[model samples]
Target: MSDTILTLTGVQADIAQYHILQGVDLAVPRGAVTMLLGRNGVGKTTTLRTIMGHLVARQGVIGFDGMDITARATSARARLGIGYVPENMGIFSDLTVEENMVLAAVSGRLLAERRDRIFAAFPPLRTFWTSDAGTLSGGQKQMLSIARAMAEDRKLYLIDEPTKGLAPAIISTMVAALRELKDGGASILLVEQNFAVARALGDHAAVMDDGRIVWSGEMSELADDAGLQERLMGLSMEGK
Candidate 1:
């Protein structure tokens, strides 16, 4: 098998009349986390969406596990072991936490082993097991979103902004859970704006600029070089 679990070459997409993802080239290595970092409006989310087939690519190829999935439906992609936790959380407001998990599991049941794993990682999920997802706090919702994606086994996870507006303590929880997921041999393509979380979880780093990946390297290398981070991620990325 190829070392890369996911690869995008010259991938381009359009949102209505506006063009995004001019030519995004990225690779998520096997059993590692690849951080997708960039300034706002730079098409980082678009890249992940395109990969999941939520947005069709206008050009280029998307390869996953040695298969070309560019024309595959979103559901087909999910069935192929690609989990997705989109930016909006994508949970039903009226659904209880248990119901949400049940729906995400695809098997219509959350198996004992997976349930235990998720509960151990995020204790709050168990605490509010029967509560409506809408009643939970933002951090809890985010946790549920992640757990939903992991409800079943998956080779690759496409996660967008897992810590966009979370507090320090909750972010730490997210960091820990993601670390566990990464350690458990899952290849992740993560869109995270929080540098600390990205640095902690990412094995590799890819930076997008103006709808294209401008830099790709080891996460440690990017963490150690402030100049490179500034040039690729922008001034707002300073001290982040």
Candidate 2:
């Protein structure tokens, strides 16, 4: 088996007349949390969508677990052990939290043991099991989306903007949850704008600019270099 769980080589995609991903090349090593960091409109989210097959790639290759999945449908990709938690949190507002969990359970990807593990990781979810997802706060909804993804017995996850619009306390909770998932051997590709959160949870960091990766290396290196952080990510830690 390959050491990398997911690989994207020279991937390119377009949305109607707009070309989004331009020769995007990335790799997710097995059992690592890799953060995709970029400024707004830099195609970070597009790259995640392309990998999920939500937006078909016009060129390049996407491989999962040693299989070329560039042409596969989104559902096929999911069944192949790729889970996606989109930026919007993609939860059904009308459904109760339990119903949402049940819906993901029906995917049949998760074993009972896996379900228990996920619930254990997010105790807040257990408290709101019967509440309608829409009625829950933003943080709770984000938790539900992540819980649903975990319900799948997937090897890789593409999580986009997980802390967007969340309060600092909620963001901290999300970071803790991701760290727990990583400790449990889950490989995650996290798209994050929050540098602090990324530093807290990511092992590897990739910086994207104008639809291409400008820099990538160990998260520790990226975290300590304030000049690079300011230049590539427009982040400064002096205030923090």
Candidate 3:
């Protein structure tokens, strides 16, 4: 098996007439969290969309678990153990929390064990199990979105902006939950704006600018170097 669970080589994508993800070469290591960081409109979300096959890549290759999956359909990619938690926290507004969880449960698997694990990580899920997902607090909804994608066994997770717009306390809780997931050996490709959260969860880091990756290395190195953080991201790690 390859050390990297997911790899994108020279990947390019376009949404409508505008080009995005120009030659995005990224590697997500097995059993580790890889942080994808960038300013707004830098194609971080586009890269995730391309990997999920939600947007067809106009160029380059996507590899998962040692196989080329560039041409795979989004459903095929999901069936192959890739879970996605979009920035919008895709959940059914009218559905109860249990209903939403049930809907996201992968086929042919018993859900009790995994559901237990999720509840353990985010206790609010259990508290609001019977409540409408839309009625839940923003933090609770975010938890549900992440929980939905994690309901089944997955080789990798593509998560976009889990902490965006959250209060510091909620961000702390979210950070703790993600830490548990990471500690449980879940490999994740996370796009986050909060440098503090990224520093807490990321093992490896990649930065993007103008649709291309400009830097990548150990998260600790980036965290320690405020100057590099400013140069690469156009802001100091803590201030942003």
Q: Each prediction's Cα lDDT score?
A: 0.92, 0.87, 0.91
When sorted by lDDT, best at the front, the candidate numbers are: 1, 3, 2
Candidate 1 lDDT tens digits, 81-192? 9999999999998999999999998677999999999999999999999999999999999999999999998989999999999999999999999999998998999999
Using all chains and alpha carbons, the TM-scores for the candidates as numbered come to: 0.96, 0.93, 0.96
| Candidate 2 lDDT by residue in tens digits, 3-76 | 78988899999999999899988888899999999889999999999999999999999999899999999988
Which residue pairs show backbone clashes in model 1? Answer: none
Segments in model 1 whose C-alpha atoms lie over 4 Å from true places? 236-240
Sorted by TM-score (best first), the order is: 1, 3, 2
Candidate 3: residue 159 Cα off by (Å) = 0.6
Ranking 2 against 3 by lDDT, winner: 3
| Local error of candidate 2 at residue 82 (angstroms) | 0.5
lDDT of 3 by residue, 19-45 (tens): 988899988899999999989999999
What TM-score does candidate 1 reach? 0.96
Which pairs of residues collide in candidate 2? Answer: none
- Residue 196's lDDT within candidate 3 is 81
